[model samples]
Target chain A: MTDPQRIWTAAAVIIGDEILSGRTHDKNIAQIATWLQVQGIRLTEVRVIADDMDAIAEAVNTLRAKHDYLFTTGGIGPTHDDITVDAVAAALGIEVIIHPEARAMLEDYYETRGGLNEGRLRMARVPAGSDLIPNRYTGAPGIRLGNLFLMAGVPHITAGMLDGLTGELEGGAPLLSEVIGSWVPESEVAILLRDVEQAHEGCQIGSYPFFREGRSGANFVIRSTDPDVLQSCVDTLCEGLGELGWDFTPGGI
Target chain B: MTDPQRIWTAAAVIIGDEILSGRTHDKNIAQIATWLQVQGIRLTEVRVIADDMDAIAEAVNTLRAKHDYLFTTGGIGPTHDDITVDAVAAALGIEVIIHPEARAMLEDYYETRGGLNEGRLRMARVPAGSDLIPNRYTGAPGIRLGNLFLMAGVPHITAGMLDGLTGELEGGAPLLSEVIGSWVPESEVAILLRDVEQAHEGCQIGSYPFFREGRSGANFVIRSTDPDVLQSCVDTLCEGLGELGWDFTPGGI
Candidate 1:
């Protein structure tokens, strides 16, 4: 009873006070979303929350139940504010246990740099019945419990962890997209855009407007799982824009 | 009697499919978070959801009820995908209507650029009984209804809207922060960080680790509502790092 057409969706919880405090501009949401798209999964939602344990647990529980997979970035570092592990454990109602393999990895990683202290040892802890996601860049590995992935706050570290988990998750057909840009204001051709989208089934068109060099313009992105449908929609959209007396670029502006 | 020491909090919902699909990197979260911090309103949480109506409504209702103010960005353009007005109306159990002032403003703005068409007029639509937040950069105005604010997705336009509403909201004591950087492994001094944070009654220390130029370093940011407490916490953290034989920078790396 497997539905091949079912869309696999995922959600992300970005945990950090620095982000909520406006000190750090988040890079993980884009990084993870792009990576997930390559794996044929759609990122449906993202929540950027503080380091509070209750908020983390609430976001984890809510998003995990609604999506096939839930990913969290941040709060895995060896510091006082690093509370993601404890919060995720509490969310799953599981005990936190130190993984022996992770402990050994940290021991080996810090062998030349520094010895494993109490704070460094804390990174080895994971929720009960969880597995480790390899982090080639750092000593401590990412945590994977059921459908929840606990990734590092650092962008490069999260990239390495995601690289290890690539091709491991089950996904549906990858969503394909084509972009067309025009210098004309979007409102001038809005009705035509709507008509073309209505005529095309299985394709969704997103219009993003911008003002540059004292000129109004917009980039229309057409997305569909089926290549033929996406192509047809793009063609019709381009034809419609042409008829409306607007020149459009093949790719986005 | 109202408590003078009460901390005001706000939450933001970034409503866009572009952001969720990683087609566009989000800028509103940080912009709004920084603005709110300066206004003495703590930005507690942020949710980036798709442009779907139900999703928009749900996020709006959930966050609006929990915080003193809730702001939403995106989905307020002339395209069919711009449905924030309708979705917020549904969330508030109200109707969407064309604001006369907004419509007049648009008419005047488009008179020179182009005549107002059906699509252009769509920007004037707002939730019932909502006030307008002026957008000097654009024709359409941002919507403000009760504790909810609907802003533009474009960074500069949103900046214009935020500028219009600056100092209009009730706020409390602005949070003060100081940063200190050190070229040392955070794990080596983790215990000291925890103890220093514990001793500082009203201060929070956030340790952000980085590796650059073949060296590991961390920037510790301490925040407090009281300026005196913030300075004291920074002094204590610096003392602790100095005692550990680490050369620390007064400002962050």
Candidate 2:
């Protein structure tokens, strides 16, 4: 919020073995990428590290230094493999101790169903000088230290924390996008595109070609914040492409 | 193939609107990652870039420079959304031309059918100075320039090209691994792991913790080529963990 014009960049460190081993398909990275894009935050790089202390430490240090924000998902649960808290603390040169607020939340969540033991209370560990990113779905609140936000790997829980974080933080303009698609060969219009791109200096243009076994076509997308510029570019590009024997339309299979 | 000691690394660049929109679940990245890992190749990075030219170009250039091999899946189809070839060509600073060999293959594939047109021939456009990575599933061959390998986004076709590429190249020693799992708390056994890591200099040790509802456990994996060192580390780590009221056994979910 300090500098309103500054572009926000983020990097994700997906820490788990289930992802690397192909045993569990990860939903966090893609979900986070989509969410961040909408907020005008660029997700520059993502590293999928196995649950290793050294590996986690290395990634945390590198990512935390490079990106504006570093979000680590997984390894926050109260399991034996959940060492992200300790590793992150080590990376930041801080001490991780059980926070009183987190402990109270865990205790309150467990009180309805008997109570939680010392092992279950492991979720209360927080690195020194960190604030809890309140988790709306469960008692295990995500912890944030400096620019690094550590949240649960579960899709619902991570999403819950993201909602809370998005409301508090400032972001850039949301990216605007529009798609124009049709069944046309990419070759015939390849040269014409070189000129369109040169002309549109502000917009980000994307052309995608597809094939469904027996059928073939291509899609052209114009993405920019300026609505007038986007509409004009899409219109002219479509007309130019249509003149070159392309079936330019709003949508295609 | 020149340096046998050099480990092979590949990055997956997934280009598609379907993937980004969550319309289609991606199976290609995991499939390729797992296959390459078994072959002693490390897949460290994966990028999902939309059908945008600038995005694709930027990702292509970065990944091509960083990794030993770059594997791109998607955006090479015959539909309107497939712009992978042209973008890749632009990224490599080459002209997108219809290669004689690629044309011949596509021609042969559709010789019996009449739907093949100048539009369908778009699949034949290959970047200059690139080898064709044969697609066993479809006649559409993937392009390989320098260390960058461009293949279809479809899981079957990507897997086919990957299989063919693996056979053609020579690689370093295959990575070997052993898992030491237990249903115990990590904090109580952290000291023992520190000792085991200190003793095992060569092996890359990793620990993962998981929990289902209230049940929790962790798996410690020691990966290295040296069988003796791996065995010794696994034995010591597992035995030490057992001393802390942990029950570790192989493949015990």
Q: Pick the candidate with the highest lDDT.
A: 1
Candidate 2 chain A, run of 10 with poorest lDDT: A185-194
What tens-digit string does per-residue lDDT give for candidate 1 at B42-142?
99999999989999999998999899999999988898888999999998899999999999999999999878999999999999999999999879999
Q: What is the lDDT of residue B67 in candidate 1?
A: 98
lDDT of 1 by residue, A211-245 (tens): 99999999999999999999999999999898888
Interface RMSD of each: 0.7, 5.4
Q: Name the runs in model 1 displaced over 4 angstroms.
A: none
Tell me each candidate's TM-score.
0.99, 0.72
Consecutive 10-residue window with the lowest summed lDDT within model 1 chain B: B1-10
Considering only chain B, report the TM-score of each candidate against the true chain B: 0.98, 0.91
DockQ of 2: 0.19
Q: Give me the candidate number with maximum TM-score.
A: 1
In terms of DockQ, the best-performing candidate is 1
Residue B252 alpha-carbon offset, candidate 1, angstroms: 1.2
| DockQ each | 0.86, 0.19
Cα lDDT tens digits, model 2, A1-253, are 3565466778888887666655567888778877777667767666777677887998889778878888999988765567899999998889989899999998898786446665568789989888999988667899988788998887888898888887465567655677777776454465565567567766665565566666666666676667777777787788888787667677445
| Pairs in clash, predicted candidate 1 | none
